[model samples]
Target: MHSHTNLIAVLLLTVLIHEGSAIWCYRCTSATPGCGETFNWRGIGYLGEHCPEPDDICVKLTERRGGSETITRDCLSALNFRKDIPADKYEGCRPAAKDERLAHYVNHTIKEHDVRRDYFTDTTFCFCFLDHRCNGASGMQVSAVMALLTVAAALLLR
Candidate 1:
């Protein structure tokens, strides 16, 4: 009985550790610019999703066109970022500033045949924690881990 209990405790600890290491982030795609309602839309809403392998960062891309901004959020594999996406578009997936949500902004101005066009983009990336809180799937993960720990403790006490 003692050895069996020890084995169970070890298995539970291993599972909890494994689950805790999994990373997740918020994902959303929008046709509208500014993304003011990105987190609050009723249809096709933002989802708390697990990051793919080697995708340790959460990325948000905001494009400004005709004085409006469109945003896309997803998980990105850090090593493949440069190889997969154009450097001119992504710039760099940096972290947001203190008290500020924007990570980086890039602007491009083109002049052609006496016509002037401007393009602007903003990129924001971060770990699961921001402003002292987890913004996405991290919350659910925490809750699950806690419940598992509670159950494990209860079983051990019995």
Candidate 2:
């Protein structure tokens, strides 16, 4: 009986560790959009690279694109192109809208990684275990193991 009880406790502890580790991994290394907000990458390569956080890829790109002169020009162009900003939004000298070019620059800046979905899967796995349905069978293996332990305990106690 004592041995069976110990077995059950061990199984439960294993389950707890698995679930906790999955949740922790989901939050820590995952490169989800919300996770990207934790840093100030300025939404440049947020959807791409899977580095730690607040990567300076965008900063480097801006520096390479004619530095301050190009950045200020792009900002002025964006203000002019924005239909809702009104003509009064800019001081003078309207530059052509370079939205397409900016988008191309941003997209080409970073190599994409698939880390976000992996973390999402980890989170889903955590939820499944918590709800007692780890693999769509409703924790049948767990239940079976517990039942076997119970029966064995009863026999031993008898």
Candidate 3:
């Protein structure tokens, strides 16, 4: 009798945990911090406003060293950035900074006409990362484990 109540309580707690997780997932996916860039469910990557068509624009900005330069790059060129995207929205493929050193190296190598050496020496790579607040997969696994443990305990009592 009391054990039945305990089973019901565990089941209710499991449902609550699942619901909370679902809500958290929704918030994280649609939230500005997450940018909806990764870890999507049901094949939906991002929600809300569609990112404006990208354009190749002359990006004029000052580097960390305070050197100003202009470079032509294709970016999601919306004059008014989307509200849902993070303030410093960085897609992995996009170049966040104008690496002047790299540009100089490329030009120098090109002038020398050393194709193989130039290609290898002048090539520079930078990494961009997406933010993840909650481990969606891990969270689901933990939730499953909790539910399974609850079930196992309930069955053992019977």
Please tell me which predicted candidate would have the highest TM-score against the true structure.
1
Give candidate 2 misplaced runs (Cα > 4 Å).
23-158
Better of 1 and 3 by TM-score: 1
Error of 2 at 58 (Å): 28
Question: Residue 42 in model 1: shift from native, Å?
Answer: 5.4
lDDT of 3 by residue, 1-158 (tens): 99888778877896666444312222222233432334344444443232233221111111122342222111234323322222443332232323334334454434557332222222211112121112232334655676698678888988
Model 3 CA lDDT for position 83: 21
Model 3 stretches astray by more than 4 angstroms:
13-22, 25-135
RMSD of each: 9.1, 20.1, 15.3
Cα lDDT tens digits for candidate 2, 1-158: 77768777876897776555421111112132322213222323332222132211111101112222111111222123332222332222232222233333333323354222121111111111232222222234666787798778767765
lDDT of 2 at 154: 62
lDDT of 3: 0.34
- Alpha-carbon shift of residue 112 in model 3 (angstroms): 32
How does residue 139 of candidate 2 score in lDDT?
A: 38
